[model samples]
Target: MHIEEKQIAINKVAALLKNSGKFVLSIDKNKDGFIDTGTRKITVFPDTPAEMKSYIENSGLLLIEQFETEFAHIFIAEKG
Candidate 1:
């Protein structure tokens, strides 16, 4: 079976977040995004979904939350 573009995109996000302990809050907007972990906050901007996913998945973590806006996506996930 072939994956749809949107699912592929989401799965990509999942994979990266799975591997990487960290993830850029929101990417593709060209502006830095913010994330809060109850104890800490982080801001980042990944060049692309692929890039962000690479970082997130490679870091060795799990769980991902995506906030969808008309302009961009907001992703939150666990850190290792």
Candidate 2:
């Protein structure tokens, strides 16, 4: 993603956090669009995907999504 999109995604993720916690933020590029089909990294929030979902769902930020894993959970907030 571009710098602007990256910044927007970061802000969205930050707004989704309820408490003060560390989050992994990166750009995910294994997507369809050009922005999503490169060496993109993702911003993984310290909170689980569940927590991110709640905040994101209600934060009015409609340009991102959340994903998670089992052992090493991964949360991805993208700009759509």
Candidate 3:
């Protein structure tokens, strides 16, 4: 998708999550993708949108909890 399309899609997803009081957790499946952890291959929960990893921080939901797996990040958010 183009940049605009991608932004729109992200916005839509953020709206849905925010409306439902849900937050999205982006996972660094590669592990090395995140700098905080090095070669550990463990799941990490990140609060900041550092390293240009994800824009879910802009989802407009409050981070309540987080979970991690080999494939994805699991996040729970509370409505503000």
Candidate 4:
């Protein structure tokens, strides 16, 4: 997704949560390729880990924890 769209989505998510509600997001940092799910092909948007983190924090959510796996970055944020 484009940056503007991503931010808008984040804002929407943030608006839905109650105060102190937690949001968990997992982003594939290496999503530069397409995925074939047998029946359809899914296009993954290329978004960096840092950019995603920034988006989460900038949406009035306080980042509480973050970690990375071999394939993705996971962020735990709370609506503040």
Candidate 5:
């Protein structure tokens, strides 16, 4: 996904967690337009969700769907 879409996804995941203690954020590139299916480097900004960011940092998880560059993807999940 592009920058705009990535941000939207992150926000949606954060909102989803507001009602639940845990949540997972994923995208199907085959339909989402990201043809590069694999782990794309996801950077954490100061504004990134605290819980989700923490999980990523702690686990150093690779949240990318792997395949071809045409199908870009990333997967992030958190439980606490």
Candidate 6:
């Protein structure tokens, strides 16, 4: 998704959360787009971890914890 669309989605998620509710997301760590094996199509604009974090934080969600795996970054955020 485009950056603006992604941010809008994040904001919507934040708006849907009840007080103290948690949001968990796992995103590809690589900024470089990769091909989808099933569809044989390449991702054109995947959000970077930094961008995703910024979006979540900007949406009025407080970041609780974040971790990185071999291929992805996991974010745990809470609606204040």
Q: Each model's TM-score, in the order given?
A: 0.40, 0.28, 0.37, 0.87, 0.27, 0.80
lDDT of each: 0.53, 0.44, 0.48, 0.84, 0.41, 0.85
Q: What tens-digit string does per-residue lDDT give for candidate 6 at 1-80?
A: 32338888899999999999999998876666665669576654687788888999999999999999998899999999
Model 1, 2-79: lDDT tens per residue? 122434554565565544455446544545465566998666433555555555555454437766676666667675
lDDT of 3 at 64: 69
So what's the TM-score on candidate 4? 0.87
Whichever of 1 and 4 has more TM-score, that candidate is: 4
- What's the ranking of the predictions by lDDT, best on top? 6, 4, 1, 3, 2, 5
Q: Give, for candidate 1, the lowest lDDT window spanning 10 residues.
A: 1-10
Off by over 4 Å in 4: 1-4
Per-prediction count of colliding residue pairs?
Answer: 11, 10, 0, 0, 19, 0
Model 3 alpha-carbon drift over 4 Å, by segment:
1-7, 17-20, 23-54
> Considering every candidate listed, which one attains the maximal lDDT?
6
Q: Report the lDDT of model 6 for residue 76.
A: 100
Which is the leading candidate under TM-score?
4
Tell me the deviation in Å of residue 39 in model 2: 16
Collision count of model 3: 0
Residue 2 displacement in candidate 3 (angstroms): 14
Q: Show model 1 residue runs off by greater than 4 Å.
A: 1-24, 28-46
| Structure candidate 4, residue pairs in collision | none
Cα lDDT of candidate 5 equals: 0.41
Please identify model 5 stretches exceeding 4 Å from their true place.
Answer: 1-4, 29-76
Per-residue CA lDDT of model 3 for 4-52, tens digit only, reads: 2333555566666544565444544444323444655443333333422
* Model 5 residue 56 lDDT score: 46
lDDT of 4 at 52: 86
Task: List the lowest-lDDT window of 10 residues for candidate 4.
Answer: 1-10
